[model samples]
Target chain A: MFYREAGQFKSTYQTDQAIFPIVQDRWFMALVFIVAFVVIPLVADEYWHQAIIIPFLILALAAIGLNILTGYAGLVSLGTGAFMAVGAYSTYKMSTAFPDLNIIIIFLLSGVFAAMVGMVFGAPSLRIKGFYLAVATLAAQFFILWVFNKVEWFFNYSPSGTITAPPRELFGVLVTGPEASPVARYYVCLVFLVVFAFAAKNMARGRLGRSWMAIRDMDIAAEIIGIRPLQTKLSAFGISSFYCGVAGALYIFCWLGSAETEAFDILNVSFPVLFMVIIGGLGSVLGAILGAAFITLMPIFLTNAPPMIGIHLAADLQKHIEEIILGLMIITFLIVEPAGFNRLWQIAKEKIRKWPFPY
Target chain B: MSAEPTVGRKIGDVILDVANVSLSFGGVRALNGVSFDVNEGEVRAIIGPNGAGKSSMLNCINGFYKPTEGMITFKGESHHQMETYESASQGIARTFQNIALFKGMTTLDNIMTGRNLQMKKNFLWQALYFGPALKEELENREVVEKVIDFLEIESIRKTVVGRLPYGLQKRVELARALAAEPDMLLLDEPMAGMNHEEKEDMCRYILDVNDEFGTTIVLIEHDMSVVMDISDRVVVLDYGEKIADGTPDEVRANQRVVDAYLGVQHD
Candidate 1:
């Protein structure tokens, strides 16, 4: 009864075609926003903000980027880490070049820089696809990492070769660098995630998103029907990279405050982000965030919970066990539900709607 | 073809002209020296058996396949090659024989994609999905809705097309092509996997599209019965060459056409 639509009526096309059309869904979204914007910030401790929440938010943004490409546009990319590195480097360079500008603006511009690089790398995608394209992007991953490693200018030729984000002030309060509070960094990540996530969702529902999906569905048919495969695909890469870039910037500036180039090592960052997209559900924004939570929290749970249960083990051994579980979970999730967590969410909603009877 | 005034217009209304066009993939020649002109407001059917270059000819016309040698002129313009989207924007739209609906997209979204060239919201507006982008989207949604209604697919408008029955999926493909408001419609095989009732439905819709909008239709169909009933003119290909070009009946009567279809007697 709680989930039923009952007598709700929509009087306009805009209202009828809303993102959250159901009244209950709208209320639920409103409640979520209230909790996110107000309640959690007031009550949550530093540990939650630093260890779990901040990473989740950053990874969720990256996963959404990958989802736009692989999920909506059917362009598999392993260059996510590369694109993110561009963002991080861009943020580093931009902030250093112009310290007077707001860090948020720098973050956005960093994504644009990453987007340009992403589109350049995405050119080959027009000619090659599937595993071949993935291999091509894998090259981007390695080459970008190499460039960052070899080119000392990217890290500002620091002795340690680690780029440090200096503390930046917003409204007379610090928001980045070592001096900034975890809560401040959390707020920044949260805000960017919310804004960018909604922007991505908006795109997925519109003409642009439709073009991406069109190219994904059938390239030959898409070509005949007049959707330019190259343009559609490149735009997907551009936009997806833009989001990843911002996430990358946030990852370094807000969460790490100081990051070695190795922090963005492809295996650790790109693979995990991609796994989130797969487990979260391809093409669903909510799935990205949910997947981020699952990935971010699971390791902590795995490592700590085992010890709590008197199954104490070395940290190295625990990490191997964690990897095995995570890998198995991914395989099981893919085999059982390719639609991922989004499909599960839909199924639950459907069950609630059809309660009391096995339809 | 003899007395169809709605099609055939006058002599100067040639919308698409293919002169000495040939296409090949490495050692295999798909189309060899095929020449044809599609006039304004006509159902120009290109029918042939499998591997007879029917699909290849359509691909060449729509800019998917570059002719190994020859010229293709469309609407008085002659370009050696144009991008597929460029051809589409120049008012060419097509459906696939294999039914190429965006599987992840809803029927509405799939149809809206057909109108991609027409919807011109810029990146900034599209990202926000507000102001001009939203306006353009809602405007296009109306067009897609009309297409959905025309194809009698309103029930599945919100449904993802991959889950649809094969017949309905084919209809959705056609609807998507029509949503482009194309001047020339290239249908690879509109009625390939349909039952009698579904084929009849598709036939009526195709006829209605040609009649109502004066859309120049180029279809590839194996069904001789449907071809005879619908096409104002038919171009028949066999073994990478145009064996016959005339009215459906004339092509049906041509010796080369009969030989291509039934094969030469070897006794």
Candidate 2:
């Protein structure tokens, strides 16, 4: 079974400390990576890459960001969409102003800008908590998007009031824009996603991650134990925003190729990402990826399957059906396994490990 | 043990001094002109009936509640107007009346979090999860492991505090507090909801923490026997006024304390 993680033993601290200590799980991950990087590029067409893979990667990154805030730090934020807009606009401004600069540097630096904005919004958490903090973040969402829309400089004073992704090259290879190859774009996203995912995994298992969880669980107790709540909460905001910012940059640079102030509408994108975290496991890193993939790919399958089966539906009807299905799926997951897809995967693996013995 | 040093001069060496502290919620006076002193390396017990302003005193010290009028000095430095975070930075650690452990985290993770204030690494190292972050994590783990061993919570190190029995949760909370290695440990009813066995366990831990780490303890407790046994000195309150303050034996013998406990008629 792909989920089985049995009979793995550690001989040293480093081996015990390895991110995934189970032999079966390690092999499963390796195989998944091989399929994604090597096989999918060869077999999958442009539609799959654009519609399913790219969106899935970007959503997974954003989910990770949200999970860091809501799940680990126990701070709920409704401003994720706004943070993404910051990344997109910041990247657009940087690239447009300095067309000769490296695109990769712009993506990373844009994340810092988002981090600063997130920190400012996250300041209210020091004074407020729970539903109040959520409202404060919502303020950030509206305020940031409002600035992006109203401020002419944010869009380079363009008459369209929208920023377009400029054609960019990485190491003499076209990595973005219409002329860029799908394989190259996919590779870029894959490399960043894998590296950051691993980094996040390690961080969550370390001291700082523990601090976030502690604050989430009980701020009073965390404080008595010498944890500075403001510092820890702010740091969670900063790191989570960093991840979301990078994803936002990639959304315009690698996938969407353009952005608008309305690009981060609260309902269409933000709620879906929140659903990903809730349906994935709240506190587990793997759950973020699982939740992102499930939410990202399901609608694609739903949209394409009916048309292929000689049942044609209008565009509006298809969109409505997708929303309904998404809503129902969210409710079902919340009821059946509030811990999210990670718990489901765990249960499946547990059953498989005890195969032929019905326990 | 060496002859107990004269307790007189040292009594004046107050680690925490609350003077003329008064807090009111509209017409209700939670604390009114309350005054007290806590000395270094001493187990100071604050005992009173319900609504006697014991908790308000702790809240003021920890910066949870700002007293309407008064000053609190810790280590000769006034902190009557300090923020909670600032109080923490100034080396104050405290537990709540109710068990406030992080429910979703394991005992180990909860305790490691206590070391948050001590960690000096920045976001760059934390995000990289290499270099100083790794070193810091390992170092903190060593200290956390020691706490786990001290508390005898090794078996349940990985178990979430929420799922543990009440006594274990309380112990884990203490472990988390001790993980901070604080100069002063404020325990609000550390043994509030425990059975005899659990109370005994908690009492032993409190003493060990005091004796081994030399941590100053200021506790609010309801049990007279536990307070008499563990506290170096006792402060008795009645209606937010300091009714009695002295060694446990001395306070127990005080007429006001006797009246507050038994009855005015008995006194």
Fraction of true inter-chain Cα contacts (below 8 Å) kept per model?
Answer: 0.86, 0.62
Q: What tens-digit string does per-residue lDDT give for candidate 2 at B124-210? A: 687687888878877887888899999999999878788999888889888888888887899999999789988888888887787
lDDT of each: 0.87, 0.84
Please provide TM-scores, in order, for all candidate models, with all chains considered together: 0.94, 0.91
The positional error of residue B23 in candidate 1, measured at the CA in angstroms, is 2.5
Q: What docking grade does candidate 2 earn?
A: acceptable
Residues A11-62, model 1: lDDT tens digits: 7667767888898898999999999889888998988888888899999999
Candidate 2 reaches a DockQ of: 0.47
The positional error of residue A41 in candidate 2, measured at the CA in angstroms, is 1.8
Clash pairs (backbone) in predicted model 1: none
TM-score of chain B of each: 0.93, 0.92
Error of 1 at B30 (Å): 2.9
